[model samples]
Target: MSEQATTTPTDDEQRGASTLELFFDLVFVFTITQFTHAFGHEPTWKSAGTIALLFAVIWWMYSGYVWLTNEVAPSTPARRTVLVVGMFGFFTLALAVPDAVHGHGVVFGWAFLGVTLVHAVLFRVSGGDDASAAILRILPTNLAAAICMVIGGYAHGSATYLWWVGALLVIGVSPLLSTARGFVLRTKHFCERHALVLIIAIGESIIGVGTGLAEETMNLQFFVQVLLGLTVIYVMWWSFFGNDNEHGEAALDDLPMTDRTRTALIAYGYCFVPMLLGIVFAAAGLGMAIGQGERQASWAAATALSGGVALYLAGQALFRAALGLPRPWMRLLAAILAVLTTALGVYVAEWVQLAAIAVVVYGAIIVDDVIGLRAGERSSYLAG
Candidate 1:
């Protein structure tokens, strides 16, 4: 333990997310809020699909930068400038989302293309040779996507929307085509960044409840439902962080260097999509449930409420499975039950449906805790 013998970890080991990276995340908060606002106005299948596609695009943009920053320092003035520009580009996209499905499709498309281009540029500049080669490999597909977003922006009707779908398809599959080597991950930085994003997504659900309550007259039922919505949010938080999050972080910390980048990409990168999407859905659902009082939920509201929880559970299951953790199957079963609960909601009040989903999530935690006890392992459920 002598000072000379206790060598300093390399820059790579010491690196963490910078202030600019965090500021960039705040932009996405607004983006998520905009998506929630757009969906709340018209909670239908059409709107849902539009929101989902938008969410997918935004998630990719945000996560792609996260990977880049994990590889290189964003503290340099130039890199910091790029982040600011990207933030504006994302902001443009969020602003256009309200009209993305129709008249402003072109605006949305252009803004998204700008963000993706920024990603490519940042990757080229900071991601090293292997990263550059990976960018080169995916360039053609990304270019095609850019074109689709621009053209689709102006194109009308189903033709236009198809282009959006085409863009997402190309970008979505590019990860599979990547073959560039020598990629590395800063494990602690990567896990912390993702966990922070999940926290922000959870905030969206709380915001949903707040917005919903704003529209209703204050009363006992209103307060009760508000508490219910808040409880559901707590359950969602408990379900993730209170379970394997710390263990998963530890797993990443010890992951072999050879497998680090790919494992982080698969585990944290992709799994977050559904998990964050679930928050958005739950927000919309919780808001509707609160606003409607004793009124029954519309198809969109009920689906959003119940399906959101199901998706979160499923995402968690996938996340743990990707990390080579045990009991992912049990989580999967919980997700299936969540899906079934949505159907059952057809016969119950919306608040009741929301409560049912919360109970189910809570039950999943309890079951896991009991299993841990029987197996002589301490569960995280009761931990601070």
Candidate 2:
């Protein structure tokens, strides 16, 4: 093992997230709240699209910093300074979220740029020490991205906005892209913990639905909406905390130290793509069920819930493939689609849409549980 790797906390040393990391995560709660509120106003396909893209932007920005703290261990003095400055920059970005694409985009740009520069300087300063080689690997691309981000902010009025911003983000993440194979110090444990954090974040979708329902009405319809929201949460718990997590960790355990960390990073890092998509769709689905488009509620909301489930399962598939696990995510995907189909039938028959979605979700859980039981039985039989 490298001296650096040995000196760093082992998986046993850091049991999940640190207290400070959790505090940093609270910042994102603001970001998510802003996202839901902003999207809530539009509540259309376009809004959904915007929210999805925004998730990529936000998650990439956030995870990169987390990765740095891991490789560099910035909780110390000089590193602490970088983190504090970055925090100020992040705060600005959070404050600008209410109008990122429109009114207050400049604030967003300035904040992101500040963070970018802060990150770059930290890399430059730490060069050749404390994984500085890894740091340099990302610095140039990130700097280019930061410059373009600011320029894109200035050009939001034209056709150039899409191309500029898209290109910028591409450059920003190119190093972290699959090619260089990511940082050496990258740990799967770090990534998995973050992945769980995201699942917990997605659980917030249920809250969004509940908050929406609590606004101004009460009836069988209202109660059904609440029940459906809860059901979606149940499904997330069932699907994610199922065998995939255990198998994923076991797969990591099977690898060499560096290999384990790298695999974990790739598997966990990429999960943000599908997870954020799923979570956002879930939120949108909830939005559909409460007060807007009463006629379309059944189909639209069901679609959102189903889409979210699909994304989550798909992410798991990719993650499992990376981890060399069997195709466990497939069953989850099948269950999701099955429920969605049943939901459609319920809608056409004019039953309460939310109630229908709830039943479908519970059915999926039951199916997975049965599969688990059968698998256990087979194992026991083999043992005997």
Candidate 3:
């Protein structure tokens, strides 16, 4: 590739995410909405497994684009066109999600293949030599995964599941098969891009509250549920955006290129799967709990609520560990407590269970702050 075709910004020229990138992320928010709505409508183990499978495949490529834009921004008209095409692919894929495991598998597979192709072509044409070489090394496996998706689309019956699982394995193992030493990590943009996606996904929880409220009569109970739901969402946001982003950025910036690349794959690429899944399940669960103050929560709804929060806290713990940050003992304890609330949901009123989860999460944050204060360390929760 010609040097001029490469869009990798120099270290001195590093920047945050661009407007086009933010717009691109808006397309992904639609996918998040689809997943949340689907799960909310049918909060079953089967549905949850299907959503997980789809998310694993979709998130892998979405994260790949984040890496792509970090190194090769769409500053040029040509690059912008390619990215917009990729956005269309994501939009189409979102449309297919509600029925992906059933009737829309073909459409989902084709949309995914298109997205994968766009990522490869854009990176090869616009990335720096090292990045170009890196994408080239992994291109065959990527294509193989995409082709598996296509074959999975054409599949039917129980056989379809096998094909899709095979596709996930192919892509999931791609990082192990290929090396990341050739790619660059633009730390600021990389961190900001991930933070933006996460915050947008978090918004789905608010949307869930709104969705539940839409069917209920406005009353004292309505106001109470709204407050409790917002509290849970707000606490979740604080848990991540508070200081984890800064810690993550600092950790990556401190590493050598090869180590940084591997950490990014593990931290951002792998750990984020559970974090995002937690948001989806939490949103679905919260939607089910809202306006049902006196009724006992169904098993699926209860598990979705408590288990979802536990998953998020656990994912956060893992994210911190991956970056070599101190262990999040308080959050880990909170995750355990969150899981224990499943019984509370099944027996007590849904509102009570919701309240317990909120207390556990917010209380953990407060305790974490107290521990930091006692140790004479700057509190991570208080720091910007």
- lDDT agreement with native, every candidate: 0.77, 0.60, 0.85
Residue range 199-225, candidate 2, lDDT tens digits: 557666666766666565677765655
Off by over 4 Å in 1: 1-10, 373-384
Could you tell me how far off, in angstroms, the CA of residue 7 lies in candidate 2 after the best superposition? 2.7
Best by lDDT: 3
Better of 1 and 3 by TM-score: 3
Clashing pairs in 1: 106-153
In model 1, how large is the Cα lDDT of residue 243? Answer: 58
Q: Order of candidates by lDDT, top first?
A: 3, 1, 2
lDDT of 3 by residue, 1-384 (tens): 233444443463368899999999889978988998999888889999989998999999999999998888788888999999999999999999999878899999999999999999999887878888889988888888888888888899778888888889988987976678778888889989999999988986687559667769879987797788888888888877776777788888889776888898999988899888989888888999888868999999999988888888888888988898665767788889889888888998888888898998889877776675576545355653
Instruction: Give me the candidate number with maximum TM-score.
Output: 3
> Candidate 3: TM-score?
0.96
Which residue pairs clash within candidate 3? none
TM-score of decoy 2: 0.80
Rank the models by TM-score, top first.
3, 1, 2
Number of clashing pairs per prediction, in order: 1, 0, 0
Tell me the spans in candidate 2 whose CA falls farther than 4 Å from its real position.
Answer: 1-15, 122-130, 158-160, 168-173, 176-182, 186-189, 290-295, 298-302, 328-332, 335-351, 376-384
Segments in model 3 whose C-alpha atoms lie over 4 Å from true places: 1-13, 374-384
Tell me how far the alpha carbon of residue 285 in candidate 1 is from the true structure, in angstroms, after superposition: 0.5
